[model samples]
Target: MGGKSSAPQVVLADDNSPTPSLPPSTSDDPTTSTASQQTTSTEPSAQLRPSDRTENLATDRTSNPSSSVQNENAAPVHTNQLQLPQGTQSSRRRRREASPANSREAQDRPSFDSLGPQGETTDEPLPKRRRRDHMMRLEGDNSNTNGGPRPFTNGSAADNLTSKSLNGLSKAVPAVNGSETINGHAKKTDAESSAYFGHDREEVSRLLIQALSDLGYSSSADALVQESGYDLESPTVAAFRNAVLQGEWADAELLLFGDRDGSEDEGTGKNNGQGLVLAEGAQKNDMRFWLRQQKFLELLEARDTGRALMVLRTELTPVYQNVHKLHFLSSLIMCPSTEELMIKAEWDGAHGQSRHILLSELSKCLSPSLMVPEHRLAVLLDQVKQSRIANCLYHNTEVSSSLYSDHRCDRENFPLEVAAELHQHTSEIWFIAFSHDGTRLVSCGAEGTALIWDMQTLQVIHTLSHTLPEHTQGVCFASWSPDDSMLITCSMDRYARLWDTETGQILRQLSRFEEPVSSCAWAPDGQSFVTGCLYKERNLCQWNLNGEMVYDWGRPHRIQAIALSNDGSLLVATDTENHLHVYNFTTRELEYEMDFKVRLTSVSFTKDSNYILISKIDGEIRLFSIENRKSIRTFAGQKPGKFVIRSVFGGADESFVISGSDDGYVFIWHKENGSIVEKLEGHRPGCCNSVSWNPKNPRMFATAGDDQRVRIWCNQTASAPVLHRRHRSTLSGPGPV
Candidate 1:
C-alpha cells in the first residue's frame, strides 16, 4: 500500500495502559476546562481521519505510558481512548451544574467510540476498509498489485476528497518551464499536449478513468490512473467514504463536521474551484443528526441495545433537530428483537454499502472536485450523443454511440418502405393509433367502425361492436387505456363509448357532447378518459370509468383533437381555429395557450412530455416546448390541404417526425431540422390521414388513408423487416380513394 491512511492499522498496545493524557488544564475537572475553552482557538483543529486518529492514539500512549492509569477520585479526563464497560464507568458527580453549551459539547462530542474491528476501541477503526478516494485520487498509497488505480476495492466506499489535480498529470514526466526532453528532443508537458485537444490533461485522464470504470473496464481505468499518475479523489475524502460505507459512522461525522466545530477539514487542495461547503450552524446540526440516526438504527439492528440507547440520549436528543424523527427513532427501542426492530424502524439493515444509500445522499452536498460525481463521464458522453442526435438531420438508429466517431445514422435506418396494406376500412380512414404496449393497432374511419388488429397476426381481432349505420356516423378517433384492457372511441354522431378491448363489448356510452365527439384520450392511471369535441357546450369533458362525468373544464373552444401527456401531468387540446389549450390535468386549470393562423389537425405530446407537437392543415408540424410556451422548431414539407393530416413523433428518442400526406404518400422528416428525409409512395392517390408509430419497435409504423387501407411500414434495410405476408386485397370497388 502506498498510503497507510487508506488502511486501518492497529498498533499492539501495552498491557496496563492506553493513550497519554492531554496537557493539564488549570481546573480540577478536564471536562469543565475543555468546555469553557471551546471556540477560543482562532483556527479549527485539523480533524483526524480514522487512520490518523488511530495513529495519534498509539503515538500518545508511547510518548507517556504513565498517563494510561485512572485515579478513582480524580476528574474524568477528555478522552476518545478505550472505555471501560458500563458497570465499570465512574459515577463521579459534576462539581457544579453544567451550562447548556458544556452539556451540549459533552453530548455531541465523540467519547468512547469502539470504531475498530472486534468491538475494541484500540483495535483499528474498521480495519482493512480502505478508501476509494485514495485509489482514484492517485495520491494515496495504492494497494492494487498491478500498481494501477482501482474503484471501490473489496466494496470499500469512494473518498470524497479533491485530489491535487493540477500536479497529478505533470507527474507523468518531469518538466522544466513547461517542456520535457525525450530522446534529445523537447516535448510539450502533458498539460500542454495536443493529444487531448487543448483540454487539461489531468481532467481528461481523470474523466477517462471514471468513464472506463463505469463502463466496466476497471483494468483499463487502473492502468490509466497509474500511467498518468492521476487519481479520482483525495486521501481525507477517501477515508471518510471508507468509514461511512464500512459503518464507521463517527469517523464520517468527524470528517464532515470536524471535532465539535463545523469547519472545512484540510487535505489535498489543488482543485481549481471551491470544494464542499460547510453548512450553517442549524444545517450542521441537522446533518450530524442524520448521520447519528443511521448509526443509531444500525446499532438497534445489530442487537446492541445498550449502545443504541446511549446514542439516543447523548448523540441524538442533544442536537435539538428534527424532533419528529427523533421521536420516531425512540419508538423503535421497544422492539424485542433485531427483526422486529428493523420492521418497526423500516430500516434497510447494513447490506454492505448498499444498506445505507446514506452515502450517495450525503455526497450530494460535497463538491464534485472533492468526490468524483457518480457516473460523471457517462453523463457527459450521453449528453454529447443527445446533442449530436438533436443537431443531426438524418440520425435515426438504435445502435449505441461509439466514442471513436461522431454519431450519425444512415437514412435507411428509418422505416420508409411499405410492408403490408389492410383493406379493412371501406371509407376515408381518419384516425389510427397503436396501443400503449404496441401489441395491437386501433383504427377509425368514415366507414363508421373502429377495428382493433393484432400486430403479430396482422388481422382484425375485434371489430368494435357499435350500433351506428355504415358511413353515417364516422368514428373520429380512439384511445386505449393505460393497461390496454379497455378503450374509448369518439364518433361524429355526438357520442363517445367505452368498450372492452378484448371482447369488443360496450361498457358505457357518454352522451354529454351536443356536437360530434371528435377525439378521446385515456388517463395514465386507466381510471378516467378525457373527451374533446366540436363543442356545443364545453370542448373538454373528463369522465371516470363509471360512465359519469368527472370534470367539465369550462370554455367553448371547438376542439378537433386532444391528447394527454403520458405522465398524466398535462392535457393538450387542439381546437378547429388553430388554437392550442394546455391544461394542468390534476388541477383542471388552463396552464397556457398558443395559436397558429391555420386550422389545427391534431395534437400530441413528446414521449418525455416536455414538448407539444401540433400538426396543422397548413402542412406544417410545430414543436412547442411546454416550459418555453412558444414554438421552438416548426417542421414543414408535407401537403395537408383537404383533410386533417396528423403528424407524430417517432423513431429513437423521437428523433424523426412523420406524417401522412393528401397526395397518397407518407412524409418523414428529421425532427430537428424539418428536412424531408423520405416521401414514401404506395397508396392510390388520395389523403393518408393518420399515422401511428410503434413505441416498442422503433423501426415500425402504421399509416391509414382515404384509399380505404391501413398500411404497415417497416425499415426495409433492417433485418427481419415485418415478416412479409400475402393477403387478399378485399378492394372490391376502390371504396374511398
Candidate 2:
C-alpha cells in the first residue's frame, strides 16, 4: 500500500472551466452562448482537452479563476473584475482554451437532463438552440475536416448531409425583393379586380344609353328624357319595357304619369303638362310598331327574315299595345345578317303572316335595293312613319361595297421613302421603256435579252433572246416608238437594230454611230428615232423606223442621254456639263438651254407636260416648269456617300414624281408640294437606273436597278409596298438578242 501511494498521480485541472449545461455563460469567451449561436453556422469549435486548458490558463494568469467562479454561497463579483484587462494575450489564451468545451457542452446538453440526477454525470441531448448555433458555425469551416480522416465537401457523408440540410433551409426562405412580393408587400391582379366590379344595373344602364348614339338612335330619346325632375330609371326602364312588352302608347302616358308626384291634376288640359305626357304618349303609341318596323329594316340589312306575322295587330287596349311593342323589341333582339333578313321575310310570307303588309310598311322608307319594292304604303302612312323609319333604315345603295375584289388584277404598291430615286441601274439593266399605250412594259439588260410583261398581271409574256450574225454585242439603249409598234435597240458594236413588234423579226440595222450608243429616244411619230453616244461631241443620230440614218443633231456636247417630247418638235438632251439643251427638231436649232449647278443625269417631262423632272449626279431631283425653265422644287434623299440619280419620271397628273438613286431607293414625291410620299426600298447594293409609271394605272410602275432585278410596284395602298420580282436576268451572260 505504501509503494502504490508513492506512485505519481495525474490530476487534470481545467482552470478555465467548461460551460455548464443548466445555465448559459455570461463570460467574454468567443464561444459564449450568444456568439456561439451566431457563428455556429459559419465556423466550428476547435476542441481542446482539459489539460491543454490548464496549460493555457497558466500562461493567461490574468484570467483569475478565483474571481470568475460564482459560488452559491459567495456574493456577486464586481463587473470590472469579470471584464478581461484591455484584451491582453493572457486573456485571449484563456478564452481560446475554454471556448470549444463551453460551446460543446451547450450544444450537447439538453434542457431536462443536462445536469444529471446526482449533479455529477450529464447524459442529456444537446439543447436545440445550442445545436442550431453549433451547426451554423460548422457551415463555413469547410476545411476543418481532412480526407476520410478529413471530410471532403462532396466525398464525405457528413459534409454532404450538412450541405443538403443547409440547402433545404435556404429554399424555405423567400427571395428578398422580388416583383410578386415586393419588399414583403402582396400584389393584386386584373382578374381579381374584374370579379369585384361585374355587369350590374349601373353598368347595364350606362351601356344601353351609350348604345343609342352608337347604334344611330335619334336625339328624340334624349330630348324627351331631359331633366324634367323625372328619374331616368323609371322613364328609361318604362320606355324600354313599353317598347318591349306593350306595343302601344295608350298605356305609355298612363305608366309615365303613374309615377309622377307633381302633375297629378286630373282636370288639367291634356296637352298642357309640359308636353312630355303627350310626347311620351306619342312615343308609346308607335314605338313597338316602330321597333317591329326597325326589325324589318334590320332583316333587310341582314337580308334575312324568318317566318313570322309581319302585320301589326291593334285591339284598342293597353295590353295589346304592350304586346306590339314587345314584338318590335324582338326584331332588334333577333337581328341577323343582311342575307338572313331576306330569308326571314320570305319565310314570313310562306307562313301566312301578312308579308304584304310588312313589306308595305317597310317599303315606305327602305329602298328596293334592300327591301322588296311591292311594300309601298299610302302617303299618309309614309309621312307618319318617316322619322322612325329614317332613324333605323338604311339602303344597300346608301352603304358601300366599293372595295374592289382581288380577282380584277393585283399590282404591287411601293410607298416611296424619299422624294425620288434615280439612275435605277448601274451596269446591268440597259434598256427600259413604257409601251406606246403604256400598257405592256419592256426591259432589256446587258445579256442581249429583252423581257415584255403585262403591267397588270406582272407576268412575263415573252423573254426575247435573239441570235444575230452581225449585231453581236449585248444591246444597251432600247426605245419604243410612239405607236409602240416598233422597238429599236443599239449596243457597244456601234449598230442600231429595229424590230417589228408583231413578228420579232429585225426590220433593219444601222451601224452609223461612230461611238457606242449610250441612250436612245424615238421621235413622237414612230417614223424615226434618235441615238446619243457617250464620248462623241456629235452625240445625236436620227434614223427612220426602217433603219435609215435620215437626220443627225450632230456632236451635241458629249451627250450622255436624250429624251423626245410627245410632239416631234422638242428634244431635250443632257451633255457632260451641267447644261441641258432643248432643241427644235424641225428647225434643227436649240430652243433653250438650262444650266445646272450639279451634273444632270436624266430628265423627263411631267405627266401633264407642265414641268421637267431632272436627276443629278449628286442624287438630287429638281422640278422645273417647262414654261419658265426655272427650278420649282428640289428633292434630296441620297445616303451619305457619292451617288448618282439614275432616272426620273412623273405620274400622269404630276401628283407624284419618282426618281431612282445610286443608293437603291425609288423615291416617290408629291410633284407640286415636293413632300415625300413613299420610298420603294428593294434593290440591293446598286444604282437604280430607270423607273416608268403605268400609263393606265398611276399606282403601278416598274423600276430597274443594278442588282440585275427589275421590280414592279403597284403601291397604292400599303405604306411601303413590297417589290414584286418582275424579271431577274444575268448581265454577264452572252447577249440574248
Candidate 3:
C-alpha cells in the first residue's frame, strides 16, 4: 500500500526554504542575502539543525539541491505546542521536554514529528474535532490502500513508517510511578476511574491501545501508545506477527521461540535478542504446534508435500503424540489437489485468513505480556454481554447485545403466551414434532391419525390417517426425516409406518414386531432409522426407508424412548426398567449405560451430541453428558408420574430445558443450573404430552396436551406476534399403559 508515491518528496522543499548548505556553512554564512530573502524567519539555528534521530537518515552528502534543501526544512516540529489528547503521556515527551524549541510564531507550521518521512512536511489538514490525536498514521496515497498486495521493503524508512514508529515506541519506555510525571497525565494512574479492575496504569493503557487497534482505530491506538508511553508488544514480536501473516514462518519462529541448544537451555528469554520467550512446558509445544500447523497447511496448499512431510516429522510430530490428528494431517497429502486437501482439512489456507484467527487460538495459551489476545476488548465486552444475558433470567431472543449500556432483555421478550391453537386431531395428541426445516408440524393423535400442519398458514395441510383398519387406534410418536419430506410414526397397534408428509400417504410400513413400536429416531442421512419396542424380545432394530430391517441389537430390552444425536454419532435409548443405553451409531456396540432409580419416559439429544436431555416418569428431567454417562443436572417439579411428559432442549444455544407437565403447564428451566425460569400456564386442565419447538423459529413453539389441543405459542410481547388463526379441541389423553 505504501509502495507508490503520488508525488516526489522534493516537491514540498521549495516552500519557505533556502539553498543547500551544511550545518557548518549555515553558521559561517550568517548573513547570506539569498537565505534571508527565501525565508520569513531569521533562525538558521532552528531551521537548518538536523533531527538527532534523522542523523542516521542520510550519512553521505548529496549534490541534489532539492533533497539537500528539503533536509534543512526537515526542522524539528515545535513539540511544546504539540497538544496531545487527554489521558495520554508521550513516550518521548519527557526526554524532549528539556530540549529547547523556537517561538510558535517563528515556526512555519505544525511538526509532522509524530509521523512523516524526514524532510517531508505533510500537508494533511489539522483536524478541527478529535477526541484523541494519534501520534502516527499509516499513510497510503490512494483509495486502494486496503486492497491489493504491497511488497514490504524492510530496508527503506520511507516505505510504511509503521515499523519505524513502533520501534521508537518500544525503545522509549516511559519512566515508572514515583516523582516522574508524563506529559500532564499522572503516572500513578493512566485512565481516570477504577476501570479494568484497577489494573497497572500501563496495562490498562496497553489494553485500550490494543482495543483501539482492534476497533480499526489504528491511528488512535498508535497515538495513545506513543503518547501514553504504553506499548502492546515488543517491536520484535510485532515484526514476528507481521512475518507470520505474510507467511514468513521461519522469521516468526526465530523471533518467538528462537533457536537454542539441543536441550533448549535455561537461557531462552529474548533469544537471538528478539521477542519474548512465550512459555515453558506444554504451552511451548502448543505454540510450536500452532505455528508449524499453519506452516504445514500452507505448504500443502502450495503443494510442497516434501517440505510438509519434513516439517510434519521434524516439527509437528515431536510436539503432538495424537496419532489420529497426525494421521489426518498426513492424509492431506493423499488429496488429489490443493483445493481438495483444504476441503478435507477444513482449512481456508493462508490466503483466506493466514490472519488473526491463529493469533486468537494461540492467545488462549499466552499470557498478556508479549502479545495481547486478538480482540481483547471484544472479549471483555462479550464477557459483559454474557453477564447481562445471564442476569436477565428470561433472556430468549438472539438479538445482539448493545455496547452503550448494560445489556438487558425485557421479560416481555420471552415466549410464554400462546399465539395460536390447532384442533385437527380427533383425540389427544400423543407426540408432536416440527419438521427438520420447520415448515410443517406433525402431531400424532391417539385416534390412529397424524396431521401435518403448514407453519405458514397455521392450518392442516395434510391428514395422515392409518390405512389399515386394525392399526387405526394408534399413531403415538412421530419423527421427521432429515429432508423433512417423509416421517415415521410409532403406532400403538404394533406397527411403525413411514409416510410421505407432503401427500399424507403411507410410504412404508414395518409390522414385523410382535409388540407396538414405542419410539423411533432417524439417521442424519435419512437412509435408515432405529426403532424400539417395549415388549419384543429383540426390541431395538435399524430399518431402511424401504421397510427392511438392516441390523438388530440382538439384546432384548424394553425400550420406551429412543433418540439419535443430530451428528449421527450416538444412539441413546431409555428402557422401562429405569436404564439408559448409549450406543455408537456406526457400531451396534453400547458405548455407555446408566441405571437410574426411576423409569425414563423420554430422551432428547443436544444438537452437539455431547449431551442429552432425559425426562423421567417421576416428574423430573435430567441433563446428561454422553461421555460422563451420568446425569449432570436434574430439573424437578413437573407432574409426570403416570403419563410420558416429553421435555426437549430449546431456547438460545439450547440453554433452556423445556418440558410438558401433567399440570398442563410448560416448564422452562435454565440448562446450566436447572432453575425454573418460567412456568407457562395456558393449556386446558389436563396433562401436556409433547412440546415441539420450531427449529426455524426461536420465538415460536407447539405443545400437545391431554385436553386434545395442539397450541402454538410465541413471544406474546412482540409487536403483532406471528399472525395466525386459533382452533381448539375437546378430548382427553390415553390411559396409562
Candidate 4:
C-alpha cells in the first residue's frame, strides 16, 4: 500500500490525437516502407545506418495517430495486442509467428531518447497502438481506443501492471537478465528503465509459476508462488507463483520437461531438481532468493503443498507484508486434499507458535469432514498446549524403572495418552528383561536368538544364538542376572542356557525342563531362577544357578506368571485358575493363597513389594495391596465390547502401571487410583500384544502387535511423539525391552 509502483492507474483521454508521424522506408514492402519512412527528417538521413533509419521509421509511424490506425487496420491480426489463453499452444505459436515482422522492424531502428508529458522517457522504440492495447489489457485495461489514453483509478492499474508485467516478462524470458535488453539493444548504463522494470523475488516466483504451469508441472509451480511477496525477479519465483494460483505444484515440475514430455514415467522423481542451478554472478542478493528457492525445492521433494505454503507465509511473506501471513496460509493448509500426516507434522513442528493462535485459525478454515487423524491430532495438540503438567510415565516393576516423560506434555494435569513407545523384537518375543543397571535390555524370540540392546541408545549391541544345531523351537524367555554380566534364555526345547552377555556366548545349558516353559524370572541374588510351564500340571520349578531343580511346587493349574521378591525369600506365581500362590523360598512351604474376580493373565509386583499390578481377561488392570492381599484400584477403560487388556506391569515408583490392550494402545495408569495417565497411539491398524516401559527412562517404551512391527517411542511433546522407530527395532536388535 505504501509504494506507488504497487498501485495500477489509467488516465482518462479525449478523442483528440496529435502524435507525430515518420517518413517512409525505401527497401521494405509498401506498408512497411510507408510506415518506416514517416520519421524522415532534415537531419542527415544518409549518415544514419540502415537499421537505425528503419527503427526511426517504425517508431515515428507508430507515433502518428492516423498511421497507427492505418497500420492496425492493415494487419490481419495485431500480434502486439494478442493475448494467449492458458494451455493454448496453437494460439501462442501463431502470435509468436505473427509478430516477427514487427519485431524485425523494431530491431532495425536506432535507439532514441524521447520524453512523454509525465517525465517518462524511452530510448527504445515505444509500442504502437496495437502494442499499447496489449500492454493495457495485460494491465487489466481493455476499453481504450488506438493511440488514446484510458482512464482508471490509482492502485488498481499499478498493482495489476506490477503483477502482470512481471508475470508476462517471466513467461517471455526465464533466464536471468534475459529481458534486461529491449529492441535488440541494451539501454544506457544509467537509465531508469532498469530500476523501473527490475525483477525482485516476487517477480521471479511469478515467472517460475508461469513456466511451470504452462508445462504442466502445476503442483510444483503452485507451491513455489504461494504466500510469496510480490517479487518477480527471483529465478524460480514466477514458476512457483503460477503454481499456487493454479494449485498445480505437481504440474509445475512437469512443465520444466515440456509438460508431460514422457508418458511412461509420469509423476516420478526422475526429473526432480531439474534446472535449479543458478548461473554465477546471476544476482547479488541471490542467497536469499536461493533459500526461498530451496524452500520450494523441499516442498517438491516432500510433495507437501501445505508445508510449503506455511513456510512462505511465516518466513517469506513477512518480508513484504510486515504482518505474519499465517492466517491466509492456515486456510490453504486446512484444504481437504492435503494429506493428514503432512498437516499434523506441520502443527506438531510449530509448537512454539501459540496453540490458540494456530488452532483457532485452523478451525475457521478446516472442513467438518477432516480426516480423523488430523482432527484428533489437532484436538490433542490444543489440549496439551493448554495444560500445565503433561508428563507421561510408563512403569516396569521387573527392573524397577520408568521411561522418559514427554517433553512437550505441558498441561495442567497429566494427559491420558502415552506419547512414546519402544519395541525392538526381531521375531515373536516371548520374554523381555532389563539388565541390572537398567542400562541394557535383553529379549528372546522364536528365532532362537537373544538380543542385547543398549537402553540409552535403544539400539542392539549383540545377538546371541546357540552354535549347536541340536537346539530348536526358539527361546521363549530371558532374564538378566543380578550382576548384569550374565543372561539366561529359556526355550521350548526344555533347555535353559546361560550366556555371557558381553560376548554373546553360551556358558552353560540345563536340559532338565519337562514341558514348554512360557515364563521365567531371576532371583535377586542371581543364585537361583524360576520357570513356569504352559501346561496345567507342570508345577512351578525353582533351579539353582548350576542347573538343579530344588523347589518343585508340584502341579497346580497352568502356571502363567512368576516373580520373586528382592530378598529371594518370597516367590509368587499365578495360574490359569485365577489363583495367586506365595511360597517361602527359605522354608520351602506354600504360605499364602489369594483369588481374583477374573482369570489373571499376568502379574507384576512393585519394586518395594507393597503393591502388585494384575491384568485380567476383561480388559481390566487391577492394582492390589500385596501385603494385605486386597484390591487397591482398577484401570478399566478398554473400548466397549471389543478390546481387552493383555498385560500389565508395575513400574519403579509404585505410582504408575503400564498395560497393553487389544485396541492398539499402550496405556499408563496411576497405580494408586488406576487413573489413566497416558495413552500411546500409532498402531492404529494392529492390536497390541504387550507393552513395557524402559527401566532407565520413564518416558520411553515399546509396543508390539499384529502389525508385524515393533515401535519404540520417546515422548517429546503432547502434540506428537518425539521419535518413532517402526520396524527398525525388529530388523536390528534386542527383542523387546
TM-score winner: 3
Task: Give the clash count for model 1.
Answer: 14
Clashes of each: 14, 83, 3, 102
Ranking by TM-score: 3, 1, 4, 2
Give a tens-digit lDDT track for model 1, residues 168-266: 332222222211221112232444344467455656777888889888999999888666655565445666777888888867875554333422332
Error of 2 at 720 (Å): 16
Question: lDDT tens string, model 3, 1-737?
Answer: 24555423332211213322322111122242323322111101111112321242233222222322235235532223221111100111111112112122224333334335643435653233221112111121111111111111111111111111222332222222111221222222334323457454556677798888878899999888667555576444566667667877766655454332213423332121112334333256667788999999988889899999999999999988889999999998889897898789888878886546786665555335546667777788888887777777777767787888766666676777666667666678878999878789988877888888887667777887764754456687998889988888888888888988778888898866788889999999989999999885758999998899899897778899899988888898888889899898887799878888888899988888888888888898888888866669989878756888899977776768888888788888887777898887746487888998888777777888877778777786532434423322222222221
Model 4 regions more than 4 Å off? 1-426, 466-474, 536-538, 639-652, 717-737
Residue runs of model 3 more than 4 Å from their true location after superposition: 1-200, 246-250, 258-282, 293-360, 418-421, 437-439, 455-458, 535-538, 587-589, 627-630, 652-655, 680-685, 714-724, 727-737
By lDDT, the better pick of 1 and 3 is: 1
Give the Å error, residue 518, model 3: 1.3
**Mind giving the per-residue lDDT tens digits that candidate 4 earns over 480-556?**
78788888777777667878888887787766556766677888878878888866554587778677877777865
Q: Candidate 1 vs candidate 2: which has greater TM-score? A: 1
Q: Each model's C-alpha lDDT? A: 0.64, 0.46, 0.63, 0.47
Cα lDDT of candidate 1 equals 0.64
Scored by lDDT, the top model is: 1
Q: What is the per-residue lDDT of model 2 for residues 1-737, given as tens digits with 9 covering 90 to 100?
A: 24353322211111112212211111223233432321110111112222342344345444443335543223322221231211110000000011122222323322222233332334433222222223222222222221111111110012110111111221112111111211011122343223225443322233344344345664743642231111122222234233324333333332222212223333231222111222212333332344445344433444454422232222223324466555643564355554454465344322244433543442333212112123122332345443322232111011222224211222233323221222222347755667858677777766666666655344555555543576646666677777777777767766667777766667787765677776788776677788888756447877776666687766547776787777666778888788888887788787888788667777776545566777787767788777787888887775533443455554544456776776677777655556666666656467776677666555556677676666655444522322222222222221111
Model 4 compared with the native: what TM-score? Answer: 0.40
